[model samples]
Target: MSGAEVAGLIAAIAFLIIACAIALIAIRIGGVTREIKDTVAEVNKSLDAINAEVGPLTHEVEALLTKSNTLLNDVNGKVAAIDPVFTAIGELGESVSDLNTSTRNLASKVTNGAKESGKVAVAAKVSKKALSLLKKKPADQEAVTNGK
Candidate 1:
């Protein structure tokens, strides 16, 4: 073959190879795009299903929250109502403590009074004994004087 014809033939083959590679890359890109579209469609369907399922659950949760709030308020009110009882119990405890203190004071007074009374009784006994000794001594001296 002539040199010009051979060069032209080589150029044509190189251009065919490049065109084939570009076509293959384009086909691969088209396939990836289709897969992405399918994935997006599936995600949209899943989101719709989740929304449908959550609709009733949202209402149920709201109702549960409302009931919980009511119950909490009722508990708070009952606690408020019974708060006075707890206060009264505390006051009663203080009263009992006061009663105990008063009882101790009265007991101390009685004990001190009893101690003083015991001391007075001992003094009276001592005075009576001294008087009896004085009376007997005088009678003996009188008898001795008469005999002399």
Candidate 2:
């Protein structure tokens, strides 16, 4: 073969090799871009699912808070409603204590009065018996004086 034709053949082979290398690089880049796009889509999908789930969960938490507040209010209302009853019960207890004290004092006074009255009755009976004996003594003296 001639020298010029041999040189041309070598140049064509080098160009073909360079073109194949560039084509391989482009194909690899396309595959990498496709993988990146797929990963991004998956991440977005997961975020959407989380948002969907959190919406209901947040609502449920709010509902629970509302229910707790309502229960607390109801308990407060019931306590307020019975406040007068508790006050009345306290007043009644105080009155009963006072009554018990008065009754105890009255009973003690009555017991003391009865004891004093019993002593007076015994003294009156003794006086009556002494008077009767004195009256009989006078009659006996008169009988002796008459010599009967």
TM-score of each: 0.70, 0.49
lDDT of 1 by residue, 6-123 (tens): 9999999999999999999999999999999999999999999999999999999999999999999999999999999999999999999999999999989977886878865776
Q: Which lDDT tens digits does candidate 2 get at residues 1-148?
A: 8999999999999999999999999999999999999999999999999999999999999999999999999999999999999999999999999999999999899778868788657767898976765677777767855876
Q: Which runs of model 2 end up more than 4 angstroms from their true locations?
A: 1-48, 119-148
Most accurate candidate by TM-score: 1
lDDT of 1 at 17: 100
Clashes in candidate 2: how many?
A: 0
Instruction: Tell me how far the alpha carbon of residue 83 in candidate 2 is from the true structure, in angstroms, after superposition.
Output: 0.6
Q: Please estimate how well model 2 matches the true structure, expressed as its whole-model Cα lDDT.
A: 0.92
